[model samples]
Target: MHKDRIWNKWLFKVIGLELVKCCAEFAASVDFKRDYLKILLSDYLPESDPLKKWFNEGLKIGLEKVAFILNNDNQLVKISDIIIDEVGLLTRNIIPNQYIKEFVCTNYSLPGITEQNVLQIFPGSEKLKHYGAKTLSQSDLKKISSVRPFSF
Candidate 1:
């Protein structure tokens, strides 16, 4: 039992570190997508249109500032902090507890379990294998939530 506990501790630590790395990469990918979309839209706007031109210039400057921050060795940490705070601000609201319970029921939350059977299946797998899990971005979740009755 002691050996098993030690192994579980080691497993959890490794899993936690990998999850953190995956989350960071996911956040970076999201930032890249946002910048890429802004740049592409800026290019599509006609230069002759004064309003669009102004918007384009602003977008370009914003992109350059982001690049500068990302390129600097010392700014990476600060940028990470900013990203975390901005995400928190952008997504301050969480799914309400009542809505979550309803969603879990309506969406096949765990595929084969339910509130009624939860107790029975609570410890079905004591020694679980790590087959990996899919990672979704906030936008992806938003798209999914839009399709559903609830919004995350």
Candidate 2:
């Protein structure tokens, strides 16, 4: 019926707009947590704090994941890739979000990619199909601090 088509179109537009808003919100949250962790580790925390190491490593992993996502030219990333379900990487010193804490704590090793694997995970392949870099550059990182999440 004509009414049905009109209603469906309206619903679809509303849902699409909501999905975009949700994606933006999710990206902002990721950036916020990364920034918060950096400030806590570098400024507020003392050198002697036993939890510093764990926090530092966790932050490193998080940043690496961000690099991986951006380097791949992805609009959205999977939570499973970012958050592992391991048991030792996390520390109680400064617990991050519930999911992130569990992801780090349970994973046996830090997420890593070898030189060969880097070509596949990020840009800069031998074929020159993508950008010429193995990881997110300083400029890319600086852009993350800006209002726009994606500058590349």
Q: What do the candidate models score in CA lDDT, each in turn?
A: 0.32, 0.31
Worst 10 residues of 1 by lDDT: 120-129
Q: Per-residue lDDT tens digits of candidate 2, residues 40-72?
A: 122212325334333344433443334332212
Q: Candidate 1 — number of clashing residue pairs? A: 0
Q: Tell me, by TM-score, which candidate is best.
A: 1
Q: What is the C-alpha lDDT profile of model 1 across 1-152, one tens digit per residue? A: 23335555455444433433333343367555223222122132465544444444454333333322221132222111112111221234454434433443454333332222221111111111111111223563354457556544
Q: What is the TM-score (0 to 1) of candidate 1?
A: 0.22
Give the residue spans of candidate 2 off by over 4 A. 1-25, 28-46, 67-152
> Against the hidden reference, what TM-scores do the models get?
0.22, 0.21
Which portions of model 1 miss their true places by more than 4 Å? 1-4, 30-152
Clashes of each: 0, 7
